[model samples]
Each structure stands twice: as C-alpha cells, then as structure tokens.
Target: MLPPFTEETARLKVQLAEDAWNSKDPARVALAYAEDSEWRNRDVFLDGRDEIVGFLTGKWERELGYRLLKELWAYTGDRIAVRFEYEYHDTEGQWFRAYGNENWEFDERGLMRRRYAGINELPITADERRVAV
Candidate 1:
C-alpha cells in the first residue's frame, strides 16, 4: 500500500511528484497515477492514463519552456495537498507565473487515483520570471 502516509513519506512523495512534472514527459508523469486515475485540472476533466497523457502533451506543448516547483502542504492516510508555482511562456513569448494547489488521493500501490487542481495565472515579464529548472 502506498498511502497511509507519514511525514517523511509524504514529503518524499511531494518531491517525487515535483520531479516527475519537471521532467516534462507526459508518459513519465502519467505513470505516477493509477490506470483509471481521474483528474480535474482547471476547467478540464480527464480519466485514465491515455487521457492523462494527451492532456499533459497538449499542456506542455502550449505552456512552452515550463518549469515547476511543488511543496507539501498537508497529508493524512491516502490524501495529500500541495501548493505549487510554475513559470511558462506562451507561443507569443508572453510570460506567466502560475500559482496553484492540488489535492491528491492515492491508491494502495501509491499511484494517485484522483487529482484536483485549482490555479491562477498572472502575466509577468521574462525579467520577473522566478521558477528555475
């Protein structure tokens, strides 16, 4: 079983998630989830690994030069909450700083079964960009 998390394990899980997302590989990130994982990212909803892959593919494609940082906010048993920030530029080179929180539920094997993310974006100049890879 993967959850029933302790402070040490929860912190490690958060860092592992951060590393996976930073890899920018859709498949790699998707592997962290269960086969039928469900997600609500902003206004979009997705189910299953294939959908997760597609979603992340499109996200990284448009976000452009994405970099992220995630911090463990809280955890108990099978659920965890995280706070994060990411910096990205659009195709037109307009930079943005995205701030977000995610709530995650993991199955017995430690793969996330559910994810709910809420985010807000603020336009910033490249000079104001803060997140470093």
Candidate 2:
C-alpha cells in the first residue's frame, strides 16, 4: 500500500513526481497514475489515464522549455501533499514561473488515484529564470 510513508520515502516520492513531469512525456507520466485516476489541474477536471495524457500533451505543447521542482509538504497514510514551482516559456517566448500545491492519493500498488492542484503564475523576465531545463 506504500502507506504511512516515512520522511525519506515521502521525499523520494516527491522527487519521482518532479522527474516524471520534467520528462514531458505523456505516456511515461501517465504510467504513474492508475487507469482510472482523477485529476484537477488548474481549471481542468480530468478522469482516467487517457484524459491525463491529453491534458499534459496540450500543457507541455503550450508551456515550452518547462522545468519543474517539487518539494514534499506532508504525507499520511496513502496521501501526500507537495509544493512545486516550474518555469516555462509560452509560444511567443514569454517567460513565467508557476507555483502550485498538489494533493495526491495513491492506491494499494502505489499508483496515484487522485491529484488536485492549485496554481498561480507570475510573469518573469528571461534573466529572472533560476531553473534550467
């Protein structure tokens, strides 16, 4: 059940999430979620792996040069919370830094069953970007 995660395990899980997202591969990232996983990303509501893949595909397409960092906020039982910041540029090369918090729930096999994220984006100059892809 990968439940009751220790500090080390929780941190590892957070890093895994960060790495998966940074890969910008829809199929690879979808592997981390259950077949019927549910997600609320920004204003979009999605259910199932297919939807998740589609959502991420469109997201990465528009958010070019994406780089992400995620930190473990808290964990209990089969659930975890994380705070993350990501830097990306739009099609026109307008840079932005996005800050968000995600609450995740895992199934018995340690595949995520649910994810909820609230995000805010701030405009940033190219010279202000601190994250490197």
**In terms of lDDT, which candidate is strongest?**
1
Candidate 2, position 88, lDDT:
96
Total clashes in model 1, counting residue pairs 3 or more apart in sequence or in different chains: 0
Best by TM-score: 1
Instruction: Report the lDDT tens digits of candidate 1 across residue range 8-93.
Output: 99999999999999999999999999999999999999999999999999999999989999999999999999999999999999
Residue 38 CA displacement from its true place in model 2, Å = 0.8
Q: In model 2, where is the ten-residue run with the lowest total lDDT?
A: 1-10
RMSD each, Å? 0.9, 1.0
lDDT, residue 129, model 2: 98
Residues 86-132 of candidate 2 have per-residue lDDT tens digits of: 99999999999999999999998899999999999999999999987
Q: Flag clash pairs in model 2.
A: none
Q: Candidate 2: RMSD over Cα atoms?
A: 1.0
Please give the CA lDDT of all the candidate structures: 0.95, 0.93
